[model samples]
Target: MARIGVIGTGYVGLVTAVGMATLGHEVVGMDKDEGKIRKLKGGEPPFYEEGLEDYLKRAMEEGRLRFTLSTEEAVKGARYVFIAVNTPMDDDGSADLSQLLSASRSIARALDGFSILIVRSTAPVGSLDAMVEVMREEGKERGRDYELAYNPEFLREGTGIYDFLNPSRIVVGADTPEVAEEVMSLYEGINSPKLTTSIKNAQIIKYASNAFLAARVSFINEIAAVCEALGGDVWDVAEGIGLDPRIGRHYLRPGPGYSGPCLPKDLMALIRMSEEYGHFPHFLEAIHLRNEAQKRRVVWKVKEALGGVFTGKTVGVLGLTFKPNTDDVRNSISIPILRRMSKQGARVKAYDPMGGENAKAIFGDAVEVYNDPYEALDGVDAVLILTAWEEFAKLDWDRIRERVRRPYIVDSVGIFRRGAPEGWRAWTVGKGDLPSPEVSPESDV
Candidate 1:
């Protein structure tokens, strides 16, 4: 087993560090945050990832995993140093490599000998092209040399551990086939397919993959609008197309547009990266524009469902986070919806299964945080399901119907039943299941 050093202690870094350790490699994780290192040293995971804590504790107990606040200590004697830092998006939506470059410089300065530096962070195309120059500069200053490779991660949150353990394919991009093979050997035990390509291809693949998924989401949302107009269901339409082997079935589920850290930022990065080479990404540009419009569409639906009354109404927001089983609220659609509704003089109450803390930070006093989903629904005029948490699907709809002042349900995720409650109004996106609102003469009488 190769000795591994991991930089950054965020979701990706922690998971990669512990996961490699679990594979029986001697791994050291380095982060400048002393508090986080202390927590990790105590066998506690720094963030919430299902089943990650158990593996972390097991790896530590097996003496295969270690944590330190010093990058020098972590990189010393490490054969493979994984740079898993963040490449956050800047104001203009370009991938900001400030954090990544800083980490690479530190790793390079602390290099003891001929160690392979792996760029595991999600970066723009040709991002690692400059890594050799930067690291060479640092290495010359420190009288040493280091090999570099680009290895982007595709692990999704919540299911990150499983994805890492059982990845579909491993891609390694390097300056030489020898370095690429060296990076590939780190996954020796895993029996998955491996692809070794130029560093540029590996870098572009991550952005291309995320942009395609974002496009699919935006495409479906746009179709859902037409579906709503023509009395059609988007789910059925998408499913029909997804059944084709060429299309396959994945990321076709519709919801409050794509968000949560990756897709939105990656699309922008891809656009900028492509433009740098004098190539315009028209399709990606359309995807980004479509997603923004889709967010506005959600607000329009709420207003339409409310029958044009916005003032003095109680709106219950279910699912505050970007998605379920995650607390990350980066660019969550719920924030914008709540902001819009609040501007319309509507009092909004919100709840999420796991995103409350993050939502609280974003929403502040703009929204009332509820521990129970029913509490958010209590006495509200209308209920909107923004995220498709499994619990939201099985909500005591009868109880919710009784609690809400007006039994109106606007389901963006199509999690609620269409006609479950009498005298209740409900609408869902992209579903042919919901018939038009039926009005009875007795209702007016």
Candidate 2:
């Protein structure tokens, strides 16, 4: 088994570290944050991902996985050094690779022997060229002293571990065929279709993949609007198109737009790159704008459901994280929707299974975060279901109706039925028609 060293301890890095160890490789992961390192060393991960804790604990127990705060310790005597750090987007929509450059320079200085530095971060199209230049400036001779390769990670937030081990495809971009084959050997344990290409193609593939997924979401949202306009259903439309082999049934389900660490940032970065190349991508730009508009669309649905008066209205928000099974709230739609509602003189109460603390930190007094989902609904006029979490799916509709002031629900996710509680009124996305049942004396909601 080859020794592996991974930098950064975020979702991708931490997963890579523990995952590689589970594949029988001795792996060392490094992070600058001492607190994170301590937590990782104590068999605890800073964030939540499904099955990561168990996988981490097992790797630690097996003596295959370890974390370090020192870069020197991580890179020394390692055959493969993977850079899985963040390349956060700047204010002007460009990617700030300061952290990536810093990590590369650290790796260069700490390189004790011939090792392959595989970049697994989601960077710009030509970022590998810049990283190579940066490493060369650090007095490291490329292809002789060390080798560079680009192997961008394509793991989802919730099911990242599964995606990693059972990837649909594995991409390896390198300066030479020999280096690419060596990188591919590292993933010999993983049984996925592999592809070797240029560094630039590998880099662009990540961005293009996310951009297309985000566009699918935005297109469906726009189609959802039209479905409502023409008195049709988006679910039916999605199913009809999804049945075709060419257009698979994924990313067609619509909600409050796409928002996470990857989609929005990658979409913007690709747009910026296209602009730099003198080709203004109107389609990508529109996809981005439509995503933000989807958030506002949720607010509008809430306001309209509450009879157009935001003042003195207390709305309960369900699920603050962008998606389920993760506590990451980097670009969650619930935050902005809650802030906009509060600005319009409405009170907000939110509850997320894992994102409660993150919501409390971000919203402060603007939104009151609740640990229990029912507590958030206590005495609220309306409840807006943002994320399609499993708990939200299995909620007691009978008990929920008793807690809320009104049985009115704006289900952004199509979890609620049309007439489940007899009198509860729910507005679900892509529902073909709204039902008007006969209200009894006990059913006047």
Q: Estimate each model's TM-score.
A: 0.94, 0.95
- Candidate 2 TM-score, true structure as reference: 0.95
Please give, for residues 1-445, the per-residue lDDT of candidate 1 as tens digits. Answer: 8899999988888988988998889999999888889999999986678899999999999999999989999899998999888898999999999888888888888888778888889987766656666776775331246777888888888878888899978899986899999899888888888999988888888888898989888887888878777878777787897899998768777777888888899999999988989999898899999888878777777776666656788889999878888877878889888899988888999889988888888889989989898898899877888988888867778878877777777888877534435556677877655655323311320
Native-to-model Cα distance after best TM-score fit, residue 362 in candidate 2, in Å: 1.9
Model 1, residue 362: C-alpha shift (Å): 1.9
Clashing pairs in 2: none
What is the RMSD of candidate 1?
A: 2.6
Clashes of each: 2, 0
Q: Over the stretch 191-288, how does candidate 2's per-residue lDDT look in tens digits?
A: 88999988888888888999999999999988887787677888889889889989999999978888878898899999998898799999899999
Q: Give the number of the best model, judged by lDDT.
A: 2
TM-score of 1: 0.94
